[model samples]
Every structure is written in structure tokens, then in C-alpha cells.
Target chain A: MQTVAHAVIAAAGLGSRLGLGRPKCLVEVAGKPILEYQFDLLAQVPDVRLVVGYMEHEVIDTAFQLRRDITIVRNPAFRTTTTQQSYWLGGLHIEEPCLYLDGDIIFERRTFQTFLSCAEANAPLIGITEAKTEQAVFVAAEPDPRTGFLAVTGFSRTDRSLWEWANIACLPAGLLKENGGDVFTRLSRHLPLRAQPVECFEVDTEADLELAKAYVTRLHGAGTQVAAA
Target chain B: MKPNTAFCFDLDGTVTRREVLPIIAAELGLAEEIGFLTQMTIKGQIPFEMSFRLRCRLLAEIDVATVAKIVEQVPVDPAIAAFLGEHREQCFLVTGNLDVWIARLAARLGCRVFSSTAVVRSDGRLGPLTSVLRKSTPIRELRGQYDRVVVIGEGQNDMPMFEEADIGVAYGGVHAPAREVIENSEYVVAKGETLCRLLLTL
Candidate 1:
């Protein structure tokens, strides 16, 4: 059983690189807003906060239309601040253990479920993947001797072969409250960090969005085949 | 040397013993629904702007006189009033509540007020909202005038002001200040007297 009761989705970015007129979360992946898929996966988590900016009204409207009870926190300075700041703003409402996911991600349901189930015991779970890309944030980690959990040591951009952060993780609320700066930076500073491998991709550029769409299409096709079988 | 300090207070919870809107709602017999919405807003489940507009619409039919009466009965922290009295020139009531509804309280407090403005129709009902005060805007303005801007607030809406101010004090007099506010604040004072004393030290 997952201990975390809250989930914080950092969706305040303008995603200027993606060149999407709206926020990245509002962009559709499989004929539906990307956030709708996120909301669907996070449905079990009782308290969910969507930190919105850059066409926030549309995001809020869409979010409410999807789930009436999901909380919305606005990072008014989203234009000037970083994703870390938006996460901090949304982090305020999170009381229990929480699963924090970046807004731009589109992943298989199994990917998140794996992270959640694996993260309940090893808190401050940093979701990492060997699937490195141009934007991959390489993490330095070592496996724990006692529990065999990967303890994160450092984060760097220079290394390409190392496991990279998937921008999805479950963290204890206490650890979150004590930290400042970017979530990745803060996690790196705090030792004994647990790492979990998950299959997820972030949609940063137009190319990334296309990749997400393709991935979602493949997922739908696979689901359809399973049903037919 | 004493720094030129300006005290910016979030009105609803930090200064008052209870939230004004829910109190007014209770008086108007819409407490259950309004109170739920208020809780939702405070919990960050709903955007403050959306919740504020919905609450205002719910209270639209309510006469100004009745609101005034309810406002009169609303309990403000005595310690806050005392603190403001000692430093009236440097203190300001910065609230998202309407100027018209809070005018009497502002006058009674005798401090400069920065609040949302509302238009009143000829029949005395609130018309369309003219301006919804974003707490950070005034805090930013105050930063230009004061050497040190100290913001004291308890809600999610107050987080912006806290971000803008030089010193953010999360007061938990009515209830525990929201976690985000507390995390961002320089000082966390749970009691009204302690909050007043903390202000003096700063």
C-alpha cells in the first residue's frame, strides 16, 4: 500500500521551446489534454494539486472538467520563476508522503504504478531511467548495502551514460519541507536517496511532443489488441 | 539602527480570529456551502480567484447593510489591533476582501488599506468586480518605500506577498499557517501576542 496521500503536478511552465501557445500540460497527447492522462493515473491519490500558469484559466477549466476535487495552485510568477519554485508553491498543500511529477510527462500507467509501489518503503524515491536523451539529467547513485536501494550521490549534466532523472518521484513531506532550490538539487544534497527505474518521457520540445503522441498511439494500439485477444 | 519596517498583514485569517466570508455566510444562512468553499480555497483545492468570485456571487443578493452588520461582528485579533495602534503609520491592511465591505474595519484599524475594489449598483448590491487585489503587487510597491517589508499572512493567496516581502512571518493565530507559507516565512508565530512581539523585534 502506498503511504503517500497527495500528488503535486508542477505544470506552471510556459514551455516556450515547445512553441505551444498554451502551457505544456494543456497540450493534447492522444486527443485529450496531457493533464487528463496524469489525473487519470493519480485518481487514487486523494489530494492532488496542479500548479498552473501561462493560460491558467484554460488549464483550471480543463482540470475541473476532468476532476472537480483536484486542487489548483497558481504560481503567479511562473513567467519569472523556475519549475522548482512552482513545485515549492504547490508543495505547501502536501501534508503526507507525495508523488511529485513534472507536468510535461506522458508515460504508461505501469511506469507510475511501479514507481509508487516501489517508493512506499524507500522514500524520497528518485525515478531514474537508463534511457538517456539530449535533455537527460544524469544522476550519480550507489546501491544501498542493507536494503539494496540506490542511494543518490550527485546530479550532473556532463555525463550521458549514467541513469537520468525521469522527473517523477515520491518524497516524504518532511524532506520536501526542509529543502529549497530545485527538487533535483535538493534531493542530491540529501543522502541515502532511493532510486527507482520507471519508463517515462518528458515532452520538452516539439520533437518530444511528437514522440509522446507516437508513444501514446502505440499504447492505445496495444490496449486495443489486448482487448481483442 | 532601526530599519524602516512596513508590516503587511493578510486580513482574513492572520489578523481576524476567523475568516470573514464564512462568518458572513453563516449570518446569511449559506454557511455550509460557503464554508466548504472557504475550506477548499484555504486548502489550495480551488484557486483563490475562482473561489473568491463564487463566494462573491453567492453573497451578491445580500444587502450591503447586512454585510456591514456581519463585518461589525467579525472578530479581529486584539493583539493585531494593538500592534497596528503602536505603529499605525507603518502598518497596512492588505487583503483580497473588497474595499467597500472592509472600509469600516479599515477605518477602525486606522491603517492604510490595500484591498480589492468592488462597484456598487444603485440598488446597493455589488456590481462587477473592478479590481481584485493581488497581494504581491502592493507588497512590491511597499518594497520601494520601506527598507524592510515584513509580510504576515496565513493563506495560500498570501504566499505571493510572502515571496515579495523582505521578511515573511507566517502567523497561526486562528489556525496553523499553511505549510507553504510556513516554509517560505522567516518567522512562524502561533500566538497573537507572540506575533506582535516578533514584529517589534524585527
Candidate 2:
């Protein structure tokens, strides 16, 4: 049986790049809140905990209005921290495999569905999108010609290069618990873990939001519902 | 903070399970005018106040007695009624609606009502109120007075007040809050009874 997993959403950061006075999660792309779109999909699966920091009231109000069953945790250090810290704050009380989502990104529902399906199947999958050179943390991958297994070398931090931005991930509880607070402090240490990739979207900047809006317009034009990866 | 406390609620989705404005307008046979404004509000093309004023003018052709009759057809949540009745002294209704039939509603719920109104002349034609209270004003005032204030609502208009409250609850009905509010609220509840239950428990 695939036990229902809990989801931890890191919505602590004020996405300044988006230039929307409020948190990025509050920004509306389509008619729905981006965070709700994330929660709505996760709500269908099972248990979820939303970790909120800046603009916590707005996020909790909406989530609670959507479904009172959602557990909300506060992160006081959101302003001075990275997403890794936000993840750790929510990760502290979690058990079983949990899904972690970046509150800003919006993607197709199938992307998240695939992540859940993979998690259910015991496959650790990481959602990935092509990032430009400027937007990438370049890590070299050796695609084995025979076995087709891509072996990752050491991590190389890049600047201004578009690469895969991992929007969502199905992480086992052990990954969170074992790492503890150091998870954000030590993500650079784990180069091999960035193996599997899925459809990923980034909403880090105003340009990204406009791109997403246009993307959504096109997707809806083709009669598709926007889902998160 | 001297336990600053005030009960602020939205009329349509928060107290009732649906949007009462459209229902009331429809009942008064001004469905077309009200419906158009409502559609515009939902589409984010116009602020709620503009839409509300236009609807009230359309319904103004009808008598207050007819509005009361229509209000009778509107369903209110029993638990919400009980909550308001019990907390009448502390509760205050803050809505974007004109006071077409709010007098009866105020008497029934036994809570103070704060709404915009279209003034009726001696001849029974209506004119606008001195000033309309935007959704956040009540919350801002309540927050200033009380150490604690909570606003329960379900819609885009509720977003500003949702930001002002110490505890903000998004009620799911005709429209849910923007996804951002949901993610940030202290609690999110669907029905009025469930919301009342949670409030009492807290």
C-alpha cells in the first residue's frame, strides 16, 4: 500500500526578484493562488504541512480556508535564511516520505503526479527543468554509454547559465531527518543526489512570472490545467 | 495588548455559504445588472465597490420590503447564526454590500452591521452612502482597538483584511481566497460550522 505522504512547503522567503510587494506564492498567475494550486494537488494525495514565514497570515488564511486539516508551522528566521532553512523548519516534525515544494514555481499537475508516483514506487525522483547558464549551478554528469547511468562528478557553481531548476522533490523522511539543520548548510556537499529530473518551473524573477503567464496562456489555450511539479 | 478583540466577518461567503449579493439582486429582478457587475468583480476588471454600487441602484427600483422577502429566501449557516448570536456584543459585520436588507439581518444575527448604503429619498428612489467602507477598514480599526482580531472571509476582497488580522481565516464558499492567503492563513475552513467549531476550540 502506498501510504499517504506528508508535504512540506517552504514559503518563507520573500521572492524579491518577482517584485510583487508580497511573497511570491501570493502572486496570481491564473485565477488561482499559486500556493493553492500546489496545495490543491497535494491535498488530493494526503497529509501536508505548510511552513510559512513572511506573509504567514495570508498563506495560512488561504490554506486554512481551502482545508482546515493542513498543519501550519511558523519560521521566524525566514527573512535571513535560505530555502534550505525553511525546509528544515518544516522538516523537523515530519515522518514518512515527504514532498517538498518551492512555493513560487508553477507547473503542470502531471509533473507533481509523476513525482508522487515515483515516490510511491520507491524511486527517489527530483524534478528538473532546463536552466540557462546564468541560472544554473553547473554539475558535470557523465552519461555512461553502456549502462546509461549518468554519473555526477563534483559540483561546479555557475553564473548566468540556464540549467535545471528543481521545483519539486519526493524526499524520504530519512533524507530530511538525517540531514537535520545542516541540510541547507550542506546541499552543496551532495552532488550525486541531483540525478533524477522532472519538469520544473522557476518563478524567481519578474521576467519568469511573465514567461509563466504566457506559458499558462498557451497551455490553457490548448485546454490543459496548470499543475505543479 | 489588552486582549484587543473584535469579530469581523464578510457577509456573502463568510457568514452565508454563498454570495448573497447576486442572490438578492436576482430576487429583486435585477439579475442582469447585478450579474454583470459580479462577473466584472470576479474577472478582476473592477473593484468590488463599483460593482456593489451599480447593483444597489438596480435593486433600488424594488422596495425594501421586497428585499426583506428575498432575504428570507437566502440561507444562512445555523452555526454562524449561533456564533453571531452568542458573540453579538463583540461581533461586527463588515461587508461591501449596500444596506438593502441588512437591518433585518442585523436584528436576526443580533450583531452590529457595517455596510455601504444607497440612500432612499422620501419618494423611495435610492442614492449612495456618504462613504463605503473598503473591506480592510473594519479589520484595521479592530486591530487598532484589540490585541487580537480575526477576519473570516472567502474571496479576493478579503485579501487585504486577511493581511490585517492577527488570526485570519479564509472561508471557502462562492470564492476562496487567493492561493497566497490560503498558504498564509492561521487556518482555512470550508463551512461556517467548521469555522465556528475551530474558533471555539481555539
Candidate maximizing lDDT: 1
Candidate 1, after superposition: displacement of residue B84 in Å? 27
Angstrom error at residue B174, model 1: 26
Off by over 4 Å in 2: A1-229, B1-3, B123-125
Each candidate's clash count: 0, 37
Model 1 chain B is weakest, by summed lDDT over 10 consecutive residues, at B182-191
Candidate 1 clashing pairs, residues 3+ apart or interchain: none
**Model 2 complex DockQ against the native:** 0.05
Highest TM-score among the candidates is held by which one?
Answer: 1
* Cα error of candidate 1 at position B117, Å: 19
CA lDDT scores, all candidates in order: 0.77, 0.66
Q: For model 2, what is the error of residue B14's alpha carbon versus the real structure, in angstroms, after optimal superposition?
A: 1.2
TM-score of 2: 0.51
Query: What lDDT tens digits, residue by residue, belong to model 2 across residues B1-202?
Result: 1224677888877776667777886666667877888889889899777776666667766776667666656678888889889877678888776675666776777898777765766665555565666777777776666678877777777777788787777666445556656755665556566567555534
| Candidate 1 chain A TM-score vs. reference chain A | 0.89
Candidate 1, residues A15-124, lDDT tens digits: the string is: 88899788898888777778887888887876677787787667766776787556566676778877777777666634557788898887667756777887774457
